[model samples]
Target: MANSPQAKKRARQNERRFAVNKARRSRIRTFLRKVEEAIASGDQAAAAAAVTEAQPELMRGVTKGVFHKNTAARKMSRFAARVKAMGS
Candidate 1:
C-alpha cells in the first residue's frame, strides 16, 4: 500500500520503532512486577529498593514517550505510599 518511496521508508521505520517501544514496555513491566512481588511479600526493605529502582525506569519510559508523565507519576506515588504504609 505504500506506493511512494517515502511512505515505504516510513513504514519500515515504524516497524523498527514499534519493536524498540515493545522492548522498552516489556522492560518497564518487568521492573513493575518486581516491585509488586516485593510488596506482596511484605518485605519492606526489598519493596523499598524495588520501588526505588523502578522509579527511574518509569521516568525513563515517560522520557522515551512510552508512558505519559502523569501516568508514571501516579504509579510512583501509589507505590511510594504503599511502601511507606508498610512501615507501620
Candidate 2:
C-alpha cells in the first residue's frame, strides 16, 4: 500500500527497526528470566549475581527506547529489594 517511494522506504526501514527492537526485547527478557529463575531457586547469591547482570541490560533497554526510564528504574528497585530480602 506504500505508493510513494518515500513511504516504501519508510516501510522498509520500519521492518528493519522492528527486527532489531524485537531482538533487543527478547534479549532483555532472557536476562530478566534468569533473575527470576535464580530467585525462584532460593539461591540468594545466584539471584544477586543475576540481578547484577540484568541491571545494565534493563538500563540499556531504556536508553535504546525499548523500555521507559521509570519502568527500568522500578524494575531495578524491586529486584534489588527482593535480592536483599532473600539474604534475610
Candidate 3:
C-alpha cells in the first residue's frame, strides 16, 4: 500500500516501466526465436541472416538496459558459434 503521494507516484512509474520493459523483452525474444527456428531448420543461409538481424536487436536491448551486457554478449557469442558450426 502506497500511503505517501511520492510512493504512489513511484508505484505508477514502476508499473509503466514494467510494461515497457516487458514489451521490449518480448520483442527481443521474438528475434531470438527467429534465429532459433532458422537454426533448427538447418538452413545455414537463413540462420546466418537471422543472426545478422538479431545481433543489432540484442545490442539495442543491452544499450536500453533491457538486458545485461554480458548476457547479451554471451547469447550473441553462442549464436555466432552455432551458426559457424552449421557452416562447417
Candidate 4:
C-alpha cells in the first residue's frame, strides 16, 4: 500500500514504534495491577507504596505519548483516593 519510498519508511517506523509503545503500555498496566492487588488485600501501606511506584510509570506513559496527560492524572487521582479511603 505504501508506494512511495517515504511512505514505506514511515510505515516501517510506525511498526517499530507500535511495538515499543505496546511494551511500555503493558509495563504500565503491570505496575497499576500491583497497586490494585495491594488495595484488594486491604494492605493500605502496601497499596500506598505500590501507587507511589506506579505514579511515575503512569506519568512516563503520558510523557511517552502512550497515554493522554489528563487520562493519567485521572487514573492517579482515583487510585490515590481509593488508597486514602482504605485508611479507615
Candidate 5:
C-alpha cells in the first residue's frame, strides 16, 4: 500500500520500468534462441550470423541494466566459441 504520494509515484514508475525491462529481456531471449536454433540446425554460417546479430543486443541489455556486464560477456564468449567450433 503506497500511502505517500512519492511512494505511489515510485510504484507507478516501477510498473512501467518492469514492463519495459520485460520486453527488452524477451527480445534478447528471442535473439539468443535464434542463435541456438541455427546452431542446432548445423548451419555454421547461419549460426555465425545469428551470433553477430545477438552480440550487440546482449551488450545493449547490459547497458540498459537488463543484464549484468559479466553475464553478457560470458554469454557472448560462449556463443562465439561455439560458433567458431562449428566452423572447424
Candidate 6:
C-alpha cells in the first residue's frame, strides 16, 4: 500500500513506534498493577510506595507521547485519592 519511498519509510517508522509505545504501555500497566495489588492487600506503606514509583512512570509515558497528559494526571490523581482514602 505504501508505494512511495517516503510512505514506506513512514510505515516502517510507525511500526517501530507502535512496538515501542506498546511496550511502554505494558510497563506502565505493570506499575499500576503493583499499586493495585498493594492497595488490595491493605498495605498502606506499599501502596504509597507503589504510587510514588508509578507516578513518574506514568508521567514519563505522557512525556514520551505514549499517554495523554490529562489521562495520566487523572489516573495518578484517582489512584492517589484511593490510596489516601485507604489510610483514613
* Top candidate by lDDT: 1
- For residues 1-88, write the lDDT of model 6, one tens digit per residue: 9999999999999999999999999999999999999999999999999999999999999999999999999999999999999989
Q: Work out how many backbone clashes candidate 1 has.
A: 0
Error of 3 at 2 (Å): 0.6
The regions of model 6 sitting more than 4 angstroms off are: none
Q: Residue 67's C-alpha lDDT in candidate 3?
A: 99
lDDT of 5 by residue, 5-79 (tens): 999999999999999999999999999999999999999999999999999999999999999999999999999
Model 6 is weakest, by summed lDDT over 10 consecutive residues, at 78-87
Between candidates 2 and 3, name the one with more favorable lDDT.
Answer: 3
- RMSD for all candidates, in order, please: 0.6, 0.7, 0.5, 0.5, 0.6, 0.6
**Candidate 5: misplaced stretches above 4 Å?**
none
TM-score, each model? Answer: 0.97, 0.97, 0.98, 0.98, 0.97, 0.97
Q: What is the lDDT of residue 82 in candidate 1?
A: 99
Model 1 ranges off by over 4 Å? none
Evaluate candidate 6 by giving its C-alpha RMSD to the native, one decimal. Answer: 0.6
Residue 62, model 4: Cα distance from true site in angstroms: 0.8
Model 2 Cα shift for residue 42 (angstroms)? 0.5
How far is 45's C-alpha from truth in model 6 (Å)? Answer: 0.6
Look at candidate 6 and give me any clashing residue pairs.
none
Count of residue pairs whose backbone atoms collide, per candidate = 0, 0, 0, 0, 0, 0
**Comparing 2 and 5 on TM-score, the stronger one:** 5
> What are the Cα lDDT values of the candidates?
0.98, 0.96, 0.96, 0.97, 0.96, 0.96
Q: Judge candidate 4 against the unseen true structure and give its global Cα lDDT, from 0 to 1.
A: 0.97
